[model samples]
Target: MLNGVSGAGEKPRVLTGDRPTGRLHLGHLVGSLRARVALQESHEVFVLVADVQGLTDHFERPGVLRRHIPEVMLDYLSVGLDPAKVTFVQQSGVPELAELTMYLLNLVTVSKLRQNPTVKTEVAQKGFGAAVPAGFFIYPVAQAADITAFGAQVVPVGEDQLPMLELTREVARRFNLLYGGEVLRAPQALLSASPRLPGLDGNAKMGKSLGNAAYLSDTQAELRRKIMGMFTDPAHLRASDPGRVEGNPVFTYLDAFDPDVARVQALKEHYRAGGLGDVVVKKHLLDTLEAELGPIRERRVGYAQDPQAVMKLLRDGTARGREVAAGTLTRVRAALF
Candidate 1:
C-alpha cells in the first residue's frame, strides 16, 4: 500500500477503471490489477470498463473500443477478478456519470485541468498541442464523476493516475462545500507497492500503443521471443564483458517476477562482473514470467471458450452499477434543486 492510503474497512467502496484499449499485459498486473483481487476481501470494489472514456482520444476509431471491450473483460476475468467478489461497471451503461460530469464541470476550471500533471503529460504524448479535444481536456471531471457516482472512498490506481484522483478529491470537496452538505464522497488514491513493470524494450511504461508490451495472452513461444529481444546493455557485446544491470528490462522483469531473491541477486552480480550472458539472464526471465503467466493463460482459454458467460458478468455488473449510480444521482439532484 502507498503511504497515507486508507486501511481495510468493512463495506468501504472503491472505484477504478481501464479504457477498453486492448487486452491487459503483465504491466497492468504488476502495477495495480493484481492488488484489486485482494482488495475484494476488505472493500466493495467497482471496476469500470471505461468505453466512454476511451472515446475521448480514440474518437477517430469508433468501432475500435467496441471490438476491444470483450477482450478487456476477458483479461479482467482470467486474472481472477470475480464478478461475485467485485462489481464490473460498464461506463457507457450508466447515464448518471455524464450528468455528474456536467455538474462537476462548473466546479473546476480550465486552468486547473491544464495544470494536472497526468493530463499534461498525456497531451504532449498524443501531440495534441492546440488541437486537443474539449472532451479529452476535461477528462479529470469525467474521472471525478466516475468516482463520486459510486460514492467510492478509495481508488486503486497506478502512480500516473494519482493526479487524476487528486482532481477527483478537489471536485468532491468543492461540491460538498458549496452545497453545504456531503453530497459526494472525497476519494483517495491507493497506489500499489510494486514498482511499475516496464516494457520489453525498457520503456518507462508498457502500453498497447507503444508496441513494446507483452500481453497476458501471449503464447510460450511468443513470450520467449519477446524476452529474448528485451533491452540490455549495448556496450556488453561479448559474453565475457561486464553488463549494466540498471535500466535493463530483463533484470527488471526478474526483480518483479522471480521469487528467489538470493538467486536473482546472484545473477545481477554475475552480469555486472562480466560472466552472465544476456541470453542466460533473458532465459531466466522467461522462466519466471512463464511461471506467473502460465495459469492465467489457461484460465483465459477456458473463459474464452464461453464468450457470452465472460461478457455476462460485465452486463450484470453494469445493471448493478446503474442501481448504485441511480441512488447517487437522486441525492445529487436533490442537493442541486
Candidate 2:
C-alpha cells in the first residue's frame, strides 16, 4: 500500500542495490533480489542502479554498464519487485551521492580501506596488487555515501558485505560526532538468510565473472544445460558408489533452490547411501529450477519488449531519489558550515 511517499507514519527506509554489470542470475535472486521483494512490502525501499561504482571495474567498458542498466531493471521487475512500492535510482543520476562521497572520503583513511576484508579479498582475486585503481580502492567510502545519503535505516546485503556496512556505520557515526549533530543516520545491515550459492563449476560463489551463473533470464534449455553440467561428488563415479553430499555443489544448490525440505533430505540420504545417479539428481534440480525460473523468464521477456517504459521508470525513480538525497545534502552542508 506504500505508494513511494513518506509521512509521519512512513515505514522505515531500506536501501539496497546492484552495480549494473550484466543480467542478474540466480545468485542475485537468492542473494538480494528475493529479499528486496519482501522488504518493499514493509519498508520504504530504494533500489539503486550503481553505475558509478560499476565504472570502477568496468571503466574501459562503459557501454557494458550502459547496456546492463535496463537489463538489471528488467530482472528486478521480473522478480516481482513492484516499482510502485520500490523506488529505483541510478547512481550517477543523483549528483548528491558523489558530493557526499567526497566529504566522506576524508573521514576514512587509506590504511583503514586497505584493511577491509572484503576489499582485500577482491583486490587479491582481481590481481590488482599494487595497481588497484584509486576509485576501486576507495569504494567503501562511496558505499557509505550511498547508504547515508538516502538516510536509509536498513540495508540488505550478503555476508560478504558485512564489512562494508560496518564501514558505513562508522562513517555515519564519525560525521555526526564531528559535525556536532545527528544529520547522517547510520544504517543497520539486514543480512540475507540464504548462504552464498555455489557456481556450476563448484566455486564457492556463483559469479558472472566466473561464467558459472544460471541467470534468471535463462531459457528452460539454458537452465537444464547448466544443471546437467553442475559439479557433483567426483568420487561417485557410478550409481553403486556412496556419494558425499557435504561439499557437492549439486546438493548444495538443491538445498538452496528446492522448497520441499523432506524431498531434498530424502534425496540427500539416497545419494549418500548409494544408487542415485548424478543425472537423476541433476534432473530433479533442473525441474526445481525450471519451475522457479520459467515464470521469471516469461516476465523478463514481457518487460524487455517495452524497453522505453523501463527507462522511464528509472528516470522517474532517480528523480525522486535526487529530491530525497538533496534534502539530506542540505542538512549535511549546514552541519559542515
Candidate 3:
C-alpha cells in the first residue's frame, strides 16, 4: 500500500510496534522510539499498539492491558511520532491479522518454535518451564503474520529480537515456496541505531516488571529517587577510591542521555582516576536526563488529559491499517487456492 507514497523509494516498508503492557521507559525511548521517529522521515512507517500480543502473556490480567493502551499512545505522541507520518494500528482491532496468524501456523513447526531463543529465554524468565501456554509458544507465528500481512520488508529490532525476525522470514519463505508464489514478503531486520540501556539495578535489561526502570512520565521527585539510587561501582568504598564505568548504570545513563559528549568523557576519566565521586556524577546525569524528559513529560500530561480524542486517534489509525492488511490478506488467500 505504501508502494507509491513513501519517500524511502525502493526501500522495504518499516514496521515497529510495542506491546501495551505498561508505560514506556527511557530504554524504550532511546532503543526504539527515537530511531523510529528518524526512520519515519524516509520510510513508510507502521507502529502497532500490539494488545493481542500482550494478551498472549498477560492473559491473566486483561484490565491492566486495557488501561495501558492509551498510555502507550501518549508516550508515542509525546515523543514526537507525528500521526500524519506514521500509521499507528491496534492489533486486536484487526481481525484479519489473527486469521493470517492462524494460516501461518501451518508453515511453522512446533520443534522450530521450541528452538526460538527469544521464546526459550522468555519462558525461563516467566518460570513457565514446560507449561508455557500454547498462545505464548506460537507468538512468533503471530509476529510473522503481523509482518507478512502488511507486506512489511523492514522490521526494526534489538539484537535479542533478530531470532524472532528470522522466524518471520522463514515462515514467509516456506509459505511462498510450498504454495507456489511470493504471496508473503520476507521482512529484514533493521538493527536499532541506539545501544540498549541497562536497568537502574545494572541488570542486562531495563524493564517495568523488574521495578528498576524510570518511566517516561516520571515526575522530578520520582526520577530523582531512581537516579540517586541507581547502581554504581559497588567496590568504590570511598569518594577518593577509583570507580569503574564499564558496567556502572550511572555512567551508562550518562552515555545514553547526556548531550555533552566531551563532558561525559571527561567525567568518566575523572571517575576512573579517583578524583570524582558517585554523587557528583549522578547529579550531572540527573540534570541531563531532566533536560530531555521535562518536555516529553509536559506533552504527555496534555495528551493524557484528553482521553476521548486519543481513543479516536487509535480507532482511526486501526481502521486505516485494516485497509492495507486486508488487501494483503486478499492476495494471500487468492494465492492459496
Candidate 4:
C-alpha cells in the first residue's frame, strides 16, 4: 500500500527483509546489512521485520519472535541504518500484504512452488520433507506480496536467493497480465558484492542453528574465545608443517575481515610454505575482526540497555510504513474493483 511515489522515478525502490530468528551475527553484517546501510543513502529503501514470514518456520515459537523484534531493530540501528533514510516496518503490521498474497496465490501453481530451489532446499534442511506446512509452502507467494506491495523495483539478495527474487518477478508479471493492468512492479535482483562468510567452525555457511556464528552482540571476551577455537587447517599439526589454505576457515575469515588483503596474502603464503602455525593465523584474524567489530559491539550494548527507545523507533517506522503501504493497497483494490 505504498503511496505517492508510484508515478515514476530515476532512483529504484528496494525492498528487503530479515526474519527475527535471533541476534544479528557477523555473517549478517558482512553480507546484507553492510549493503543495506550503504543503499539507504541512494535508494528508496523499505526494511521489513518479517515476523509474519518467521511464523512459516517457527509456528510454535511466536513468543520467541515477539521478543526478538526489538533486538532486530537495534541491530539494524547499530549497523548504521538511518531511520530517516530507510522505511522500517514489521510485515505483520501491514495487513495489506496478506490481502495481496491471497489474490496472488490463485495465480501460482502448487507445482511451481514445489519447484522453487530455495524452498526445496529449505524443506530438506528443516526435515519438513513431505510434511511441509501449507503456510511454509506458500512463502514465496507471501514474499511476492511484500515486494509488490511496496512496488519494489529492486531486491538485494545473495546469489543463493536469486530464485526467490525471480519468483517474485514472475508473480508480479503474472498478476499484471492476468488482471490486464500493471498494478505491481516487477522486481529485479541486486546481487551482493561480498562473498558469503563461512562459519567459525568452518561450515560452508554461518547460521545461528550451527552454533558457529559470531554475533554482533558478542563481548570482547566472547569474540576472543570464539576466534581462539575457530576451525583452521587440520593438516598443519606442527609449526613447521605446510598448512592448507584452500579450505581453511581462518583464511575465509581473513578474506572477509582483513582490510590489508596483501598482508593476508603474504600470511597465506607463509602458512602454505611451512613454519606458520594455525594459532598465529587465528590470532591475527582475531585482532583484525576485533578492530572491525569493536565499535558495533559498543553501540549494541548501549541500545540493549534502552529497550523502550528501540520499541519507539520501531513504532515510528511502522506508522510511516503503514501510510505508504496503505496507499498502495488502495490503488490495488481500485484496480481490481
- TM-score against truth, every candidate: 0.96, 0.97, 0.96, 0.96
Please, what are the lDDT tens digits per residue for candidate 4 over residues 286-317?
A: 99988878888777788889898888878887
Per-residue lDDT, model 3, residue 65, is 90
Of 2 and 4, the candidate ahead on lDDT is 2
lDDT of 4: 0.86
Q: Candidate 3, after superposition: displacement of residue 267 in Å?
A: 0.6
**Candidate 3 per-residue lDDT over residues 31-114, each given as its tens digit:** 999998898887878899999999988999989899999899999999989888888999999999999998899988899999
Each model's C-alpha lDDT? 0.87, 0.90, 0.88, 0.86
Which numbered prediction scores highest in TM-score against the true structure?
2
Residue 326, model 1, lDDT: 81
Number of the top lDDT candidate:
2
What is the per-residue lDDT of model 2 for residues 161-210, given as tens digits with 9 covering 90 to 100? Answer: 89999999999999999988778888888889998888898898788888
> What lDDT score is found at residue 239 in candidate 2?
92
Shift of residue 123 alpha carbon in model 1, Å: 0.2
lDDT of 1 by residue, 13-126 (tens): 888779997878888888767888888887888999999999999999969899999998888888888888899989999999999899999999899999999999999999
lDDT of 1 at 315: 90
